[model samples]
Target chain A: MTVGNTTTQRSADATATGAAVEIDQVAVRFRTKKKDVTALRDVSVRIEPGEFVAIVGASGCGKSTLLKLVSGLLRPSSGQVRLHGEDVRGPRRDIGYVFQRAALLDWRTARRNILLQAEMRGMPRAQARQRVDELIAMTGLTGFEDAYPNELSGGMQQRVALCRALLHRPPVLLMDEPFGALDALTREQMNVELRRIWRETGTTVLLVTHSIAEAVYLANRVIVMTPRPGTVAEVIDVDLPVERDYGQTMSAPEFARATGRIRDLLGATTTAE
Target chain B: MAAQSTIEQPERTAPAGATASATRRPGGAGAGLLRFARNTWRPAAVLAAILVVWWLVTAADLVKPYLVPSPGTTLDVVLAQPGYFAHHTWITTYETVLGFAIAIVVGVLSAVVMVYSPTVEKSLYPLLLFAQVIPKIAIAPLFIVWLGFGLSPKVVVAVLMAFFPIVISTVTGMKSIDPEMLQLSATMGAGPAQTFRKIRFPAALPHLFAGLKVAATMAVTGAVVGEFVGANEGLGYVILQANGNLDTPTLFAGLIIMSLLGVLLFVVVELLEYLVLPWQASRRTDATTTTL
Candidate 1:
């Protein structure tokens, strides 16, 4: 509680003002000719700017649906999603999205791939290049600006994606299991890099993952979701220092408490959706 | 120490993938020869066996002299009349090349149109299928009758023969783009044009070149079919004349020359693929070979 950082200070400030993202009683359903599938229902979350929120759920939980709502990639059957207090009507241009796969353009170099966000937004060339340099440096992708996605490692590709997402410096970032595809050690290393990047950039992030420990370690608050016709089962506040060391944070009581509570919540609902 | 390790730790991931790929990659000169032989020896031996049988069938006079002709006789026929054969080959090559260029433009444009408009796809898909499924030989006479015995009929036949492969391959390529990429690009504020240009178009190149290579061979056959029906000048005309006059050596020479044209165009498309898609060719080439 005594540890102070700009990330923590800005997080506190964001709560007093407008929320960065507000998912109000959102429900999403997909209908086919033969059947109707309810993806999510009665889901609500309020994410403060500069806050890290992780939604932990098993496959088919619609934790990913929650992110789609915020990004305006999907619409809820009911309720509403708002970004920066504005209702999301269509695909919102003011946000960045990272997927499990880095989704880097195979033909493009890492720098050019990152610049895609800028080019799409019509950002000034010199300004976009300058911002790209900053992100490349921040992500430790300095020397590999010219490498294609195929030439890069899984972790490096994800870093390029992270840089691309943060290029516009949007107020909110949405990640769908951004580190899920990496190996265990690489995933941990990415988790640490992501935390540092999040602190440095101070962008509000909504991350969806299946890993309980990942949610507890990287997020200020964890939203545990139930499977199929998913809804928020519980919200866990990880009462740990804003600046977390991998070894220290993993061993912290708060981390264990948060993870334990989430495991129990997910475990009980295993038999039914 | 933590900060120093952070920089170094991420780089460790790089070497793991690099080394794994290195093991799969074609090896040094000595190892490469072994792998090359493994992948290619069967095809080489099969071709050699066919050539020997062809020579024996002629040498033993199992067939009439004018019916099969010796391989040496066919070679002499080509060597004796280089200018005459060259003129006919040039005509066919020109017609096929022109038709192939047109096919690429039309094929790609139509594919783009079809992908963007479901209505266009629905309307044109059946016609495209029919074009591909129909025997070009059966329809060659129709094109010749409609356009007459000249460059126009031969070129038209070549276009019809070649364009379907390009269309199908190009459509598959454009549609094969990861849907997630489209969503991500949409979130980035890319409009349809921007998405197609940056995400869809470049992603489709490797497939498009693949289509072009297939189309290259088809175009040559189409041109020859056109000549088979009606032509004043071309390798097909040479072959037709030889067949009528029972000049088996000329007939064999014409067939070889036409096949060489197809191979030449195929090689050209391959070279273009390498130049245009430097990123894909290395990985793409490796996946095609069965080294074991």
Candidate 2:
């Protein structure tokens, strides 16, 4: 725990936790009025402990559906999603989920919103208070504890949302396009912040993003997914250095190559669609 | 053309910081008063103009005084017999408040039930609709027959009149929660009760208040309607009594008092809304201004 000090060194004192994910040939078919639409087909990917993985694809390519499956919000039509070698039968308290929208309760202030995790999990009040303070500082939301979600900016609201998600120090953090709604500049800033937090907390992150560049910029490995009946198209390693800068990372050759490859995969899918 | 260009340019200029500044600008009590005055003045001026026109028509003897009393005559009646109206107003207010309370509790609980259980909703939705379709005024006399012409029938009528809007708005509010938020709550491992308290109920408040404001005014109408059917006291009774005696001024005085009661109740609801949902109201203003 040192807050806002961007470093690659892991917190040895940080709670020993990282949820490894194994997607075993999972396929999801949603039965709607019109048809039994297959969202994912044979999507098998094993994420290592403490790894930051980004899944990127065109809209409707089951990127979010895959995240849902892992988070136990949805069960696959076939196969299984396992966390830390344990089957995900239902929503696991050990995993944190961040939605696309900040989804902050409009009535709750930033501090109250962050404390929601403690309230839900019934964490000891004093300890949860200490954790919330640290998280608020880490997320750069120190002065905005009393500010309502509507009072905060889009980026600030998302920061509160992130704080709420991480307050419980969950082993796995699943994000579904968390910064997709933000503008380009804010989104980039959030990316840097997210990377710093990930580095500090050492929590395993499974991020679903539509932006190819974003996927490369944050994740250790980018899982490119195909359109419609989405499965892993390619698992491209982001071969950039671990110590990354938002402005400098984009210009790195490896970054360019990784993003470029993901872009082509996405482009191919759109044409096929 | 200039306005359109200005609007287009703000998209480039309106950063997240703009909203913070916008809220901070309205800082002091003076600014608040100014804002209130700015909003209120136009309607106040229109009302004044209408009164002036009304006074002129009456001064010119355009209508028979017996048929429609002059504003001055009505005001005089209100002033001269303050005790007469006060007693009736008190009775009506009590009935309205009690009925409104009943409507709110029943309506909200029903809304929660409907939202949580589809089977209950499927079973009761048609019956709820049927209740709404029946003219409450037509059944007011029936309530009087069943419950007698005391506060009971009046309260029942008020509840009938006020229930629908509260139920409808609450249902909409409860259901209006972003699906993603619910999913996030689920993934947070919140039990159903915790999720409802933390997310669903708070989200529903703005919509509930909208319904409450409507129901508050309707409650007064319901109370008065019940009195109109059968009552010994209340503004409704006064109006009916005045009409029987052809005392037009007293009738107009009763009308004014009833309207005042409705306005007063509506204002109270609005104040409660401001207290409960400062975030919601402020957000709307910020959203509109940021577009500019």
Candidate 3:
């Protein structure tokens, strides 16, 4: 992935290829009419290339804010968020964001929404069309490509959203509680699909979710965050093997242990706050 | 998502109120027709009863024939001078259409400007509301003063009347977009123009069409009001001359023709909405069913 802004040199260990994110003492403040609210404070983390990282936190823990900072959607009030080796100044084409809701354009058909990436980039029509067909197939949305968003079920709509995010093949993917809206069974199934896709594409992913099970099931490392003026409370590494299946992962002892540890950390943070 | 039941889902129900008989499962074409007639007959019966009461009133001379012409006499007048009514209808139709077209362009452009800039919205929104409060009928004569007694004055009045609703609805539609949708677009590297073209505009279309339907009927009234003040042609002029001469049948004929013009325009707008926003039309649920 090509980095931006040459003024700051790359860190010695950061690579020239593969998407890498470095959050250096990042902070975000909202200046409201009544007072200044610190959304995030001195939050620092690094995501290596192709690593699947999940952040688990309560509502006001600034998990979504961190994702925004990484995607260059929000500027850090202090320090910097770097993609690859360069600082992120604004939105770039190399990052993909999947919102909590499917958020598909209701007017556009499923295929057209996926091709929105190409439309935004001014990519060649023929190439975009070919890519759209492949993504529809990849996301198991073959027959439903022409369907409007309202015609699809909630889970199907989220699948369409996933296809749209992955259409441009961005080096880094950021997801904010993507499966949180689905029912339990569908959410588990989608978790399986997401893991399979991540394994296949080897794209670096940073997912923020409120579900502890989801964070442990999907990521190599789960970042537990504290609430209000949010900062990282603990980073728990998942010792489970990379080749995880929904059924097997849930039953595994290591999975239980990792989730239990993160849960305890979260419980303690909320009480202390 | 796992497929549920999968019995083809009954061909997806038509938009709400479009198919009251659509719920009935019919064994044959005859049954389908009977069901359709059953759903439609109530309204038809009410209309027939009203007509009967009117005829009885006329026969008993409850009201003067000149003041309130019998429905039959109005029909006869309409049949007698079809060409004259048609000429005036065409003129009124042109003015309404032209004014509506101009309103759509100017209103939507203004809405876009206001949506994109906070300063413009703050300054212009109250003024738009102010313009909406002043009755368009009151200003119809002023348009004639500036543009003279021609098609321009009538068209101007129609535009002034139709413009506010379109702008209000368009602005509402643009702002109603989910914040997540905007954030997703930003992450996709979409510039302002691209976001508006592909996302905001298309999403706003259903609301825009809703406003257009209201504006379409308003346009006809606006044109007629302008004609009421000063015009040599149009159904409004026909009505005014007939009223002066106490030609009640001709006046009633003019009123019918003018209203028919408005209804036709409204239907045309609805058809356009269906074509452009099939997704929205198809997704509508029955209003009663949607109550919490």
Recovered fraction of real interface contacts per model: 0.41, 0.50, 0.44
Question: Model 3 chain B, poorest ten-residue lDDT window?
Answer: B13-22
The true-versus-predicted C-alpha distance at residue A63 of model 1, in Å, is: 1.0
Q: Model 3, which residues run further than 4 Å from truth?
A: A1-19, B1-62, B285-292
**Predicted structure with the largest DockQ when compared to the true one:** 1
Candidate 3 Cα RMSD (Å): 6.5
DockQ of each: 0.36, 0.31, 0.30
Instruction: Evaluate chain B of model 1: give its TM-score.
Output: 0.83
Across B162-205, the per-residue lDDT of candidate 3 in tens digits comes to: 99989999999999998888888888778888899888998889
Provide all candidates' interface root-mean-square deviations: 6.7, 9.3, 9.6
Q: How well is candidate 2 docked (DockQ)?
A: 0.31
What is candidate 3's local distance difference test score?
0.81
For residues A109-154, what per-residue lDDT tens digits would candidate 2 score against the true structure?
7888888889888899999999999987787776567666766678
TM-score of 1: 0.87
- Give per-model TM-scores: 0.87, 0.88, 0.88
TM-score of chain A of each: 0.93, 0.92, 0.92
Q: After superposition, which runs of candidate 1 have C-alpha atoms over 4 Å from their true positions?
A: A1-17, A271-273, B1-72, B285-292
Report residue A94 deviation for candidate 1 (angstroms). Answer: 1.4
Candidate 1 lDDT for residue B215? 96
